[model samples]
Target: MATTNVREITIALRSDGEGLLNSLVDELSRLAQEAVNFMKRTAPKWRSTLTNSIRADKISDFEWDIGPGVEYAPAVEEGRAPGKGLPRWEDPAAADIVQWLATKVFAGRRRARRTSMKAVHENLELRDRYQGLAWHVRHHGIKAHPFAAPTLDMMERSFPARLELAARRYLATTGSGGAA
Candidate 1:
């Protein structure tokens, strides 16, 4: 659902000349790769989760996908309302500690002797200690920290000159006389 809301940037070039197409494709691919690098560098450093999930794949000789794969990537990019996103454990080790305390220390007490394992698991106090921290974070959602948009902005500022330069180099190297 989050991915459906993802913003995409498409760069296209139309050339009528026959031999210029291959040069354009190569230049576009290079530009896409450069943009992907820019996005990855600009991505937030929190847990590096979003950054690590970023990918850039050439859909065709002309297109690329440059974004994160994680489901929450868009949520992080776009922000979310309080209580809207999935809860993420702040400390998995702490949850294990809480489970141990519930099953070992508390379960050994006389009053807890009559309690079933299911009842112990369902104990509100134990559940709260284990899950409450995560819930609290999700209840107040994180603010958006956009990476893709800024990367696109940077690319837009420089891509024309970069493309033109690449085209010039390609033509000069290939000794092509046609218009690019």
Candidate 2:
């Protein structure tokens, strides 16, 4: 629910545009799902939690929200600024960092086959290493991954065409010729 990188677009409708949203609901839902999938694809695949948290929700009659469900979503998307203190939740032996270290540092090794990070987490030597890495992160801010931004850019570029398509579909369904 900690949404970030929020983008809003408003559509102006004619005075008598009653039920126009109903006609386009399916198309809009599809668009929202597409955006979620795009975000999932673009998100960094460290342990896959962030990517998996991506989802779409209908907030109002004409509003849809597509974003991640995790608390760290914003941090992952926008990154932390340099010199920002480590989050209170993240300690040196945090399961996530340990898992990431297992996945990254010893890639292609036997340890990679294990899913649980219990072994890595309990290892004192690895804990020290993760602590060092965490310390470094505190000093140097993480770079923005920009999954949401790119999706917004893609949506901006394709929105006009998509709206036209939806409008044409609606008009065709209602058999309304361009008389106005």
Candidate 3:
């Protein structure tokens, strides 16, 4: 089977004091909560499927580097350029790494799906909808928030119930005299 990949953003901080670990953990817990909240509003899949399942403890942190002698700017946009509406990154260097990771993740997902029989067998409309997500991630990357419509996770979580509900409705309308 072809491989699938996901990009996870990581950052590192060097601390000298004993209390630093506690401080860092506290901050990361806050960040995880923020991430969960963001997902709920932006990506409802998390709400319906993973709402109670997720917590700060479930988030894992790892070390990463901006590298030696690097000057970093925050991810937020600061000033606009003459032609560009908002600078892609306040810190160009870190942004470059994040973009690269996102690209790899997108490409890997597409390649894996292209090779999968299930992906090939789906009807055009369904395939298009699914593949469109792959392409969207490839081109624009997955948001920290859900900007796209309901995702695969959402569909998987809710579609079965939806399908069953529709089937019941259809049977109710048709009754026993309806076409077999």
Off by over 4 Å in 1: 1-19, 83-140, 174-180
Candidate 3: the clashing residue pairs are none
The models' CA-based lDDT, in order, is 0.65, 0.71, 0.37
True-structure RMSD for candidate 1: 12.7
By lDDT rank, best first, the candidates go 2, 1, 3
User: Which consecutive 10 residues in model 2 have the weakest lDDT in total?
Assistant: 4-13
Candidate 1 lDDT over residue span 1-180, tens digit each: 223211221111232234456777878888887887888888876567778888888888767887888876676678767765343334564554355446654665554433677566556666565465446546886578888889889888998887777666665565442223
Off by over 4 Å in 2: 1-20, 85-93, 111-122, 178-180
Model 3 TM-score, all chains together: 0.23
Measured by C-alpha RMSD in angstroms, how accurate is candidate 3?
25.4
* Residue 131 shift from truth in candidate 3, angstroms: 21
Q: In what order do the candidates fall by TM-score, top score first?
A: 2, 1, 3
lDDT score, candidate 1, position 166: 69
lDDT of 3 by residue, 1-180 (tens): 543221210111122223334444445444445544543454324114333433334424422121112122111112122322222223563344344444544554543365577555533434344445445545564334322223335545654554445434443353421111
Q: Estimate each model's TM-score.
A: 0.56, 0.72, 0.23
Between candidates 2 and 3, the one scoring higher on TM-score is 2
Report the lDDT of model 1 for residue 122. Answer: 52
What does the lDDT read for residue 168 in candidate 2? 63
